[model samples]
Target: MSSPRQQHWENVYSTRQADEVSWFQDDPTLSLDLIARSGISANAPIIDIGGGASVLIDRLLDAGHSALTVLDISHVGLTVAQKRLGDHAGRVTWIAQDVTAWHPPQDAFALWHDRAVFHFLVEAADRAAYVRALDRGLRPGGFVILAPFSLTGPERCSGLLVRRYSAAMLQAELGADYALVNQQPQTHLTPAGNRQDFIWCLFRKSAT
Candidate 1:
């Protein structure tokens, strides 16, 4: 059974080259910078939510992260990423599941990273589900690098409505167990040469 979200993304990946997508980036510089600032070791367990066909996996594998998981709803997107990785694909654990509905492994990831995915949860219930998953997925001392459209960013992307956020808004939404460690504003130049505003937040799960 194909979900509408899955079908839409499947078409997006099938009809467009990975780099041809509007959100495509040759090097995920902002993401890498935030991850580096989190101070996690290269061998730390990490999950890239809604990773799909993003090249973050390539960068992570190159940097020697051992426990890596990439989860997305679209099978086409994941298949393309696996094909791009070739033999290196075996090094990664790929799960094709909707982020809002999937149950994450218990305290499994040292770091959880999401870009553009959070903003897409326009419905309050979906956003709540995302937070629940986050709380369940990360280790107590783990870090989360979340990147979403800022309040000033586009109201819609890829034909879907999005809920933009500031660092403060994101913090409030995630609740008290996660504390904001660092944040940065990014001006991303999409593959189509359009500018998109984004806020990247680094949060640590409280040890208490």
Candidate 2:
């Protein structure tokens, strides 16, 4: 039996066209740019949290990134991406699991990227669990690129409440072990032509 969180996303992906979703982005330019700014090599291990049907995976693969893992709570979402990728899908690793509950291999990733997922953790415990996973999965000196709803963004999305953040708030959540490197505010234009505010932050883990 799927968890409520998993079931919710599975239903969303199963019923909606990928490109028609509210969070859908055809280019994913900011994500790609942040990945480039991380300075990791093409072969470095990277994981995309809540990757779902996002085309970021497709862009990464096209850029010669070899070690890529995409984790989504929804199996249906993963399937959508796989179908879109076809033969190229086999090049990436797909894991269907909740971000807070999943256990990652220690020091397994060189870079961790999340876009619009962290904000969904409305509870303190859930946010802490996500941080724990981040600490365990991301290697020392690794980069973290997080794009969550800005403080000015919407209070709700997809029938769920979200916790918005500024760069300082996000840095506080990550704590001192991760140093904030850069931040950019984005006004995202949804498929329906509505604007959503996002705060993108890049942090590098302490090498010690």
Q: Which 10-residue window of candidate 2 scores lowest in summed lDDT? A: 1-10
**How much lDDT does candidate 1 score?**
0.92
Give each model a TM-score.
0.98, 0.99
Alpha-carbon local distance difference test for all models: 0.92, 0.95
Model 1 C-alpha lDDT per residue in residues 1-208, reported as the tens digit of each score: 8889889988898999888887888899988888889899988999999899999999988988888999998899999999999999999999999999989988999999999899999999999999999999898989999999999899999989999999999999999999999999988898889999999999999976
Q: Which ten residues in a row have the lowest lDDT in candidate 1?
A: 17-26
Candidate 2, residue 110: how far the Cα is off, in Å = 0.5
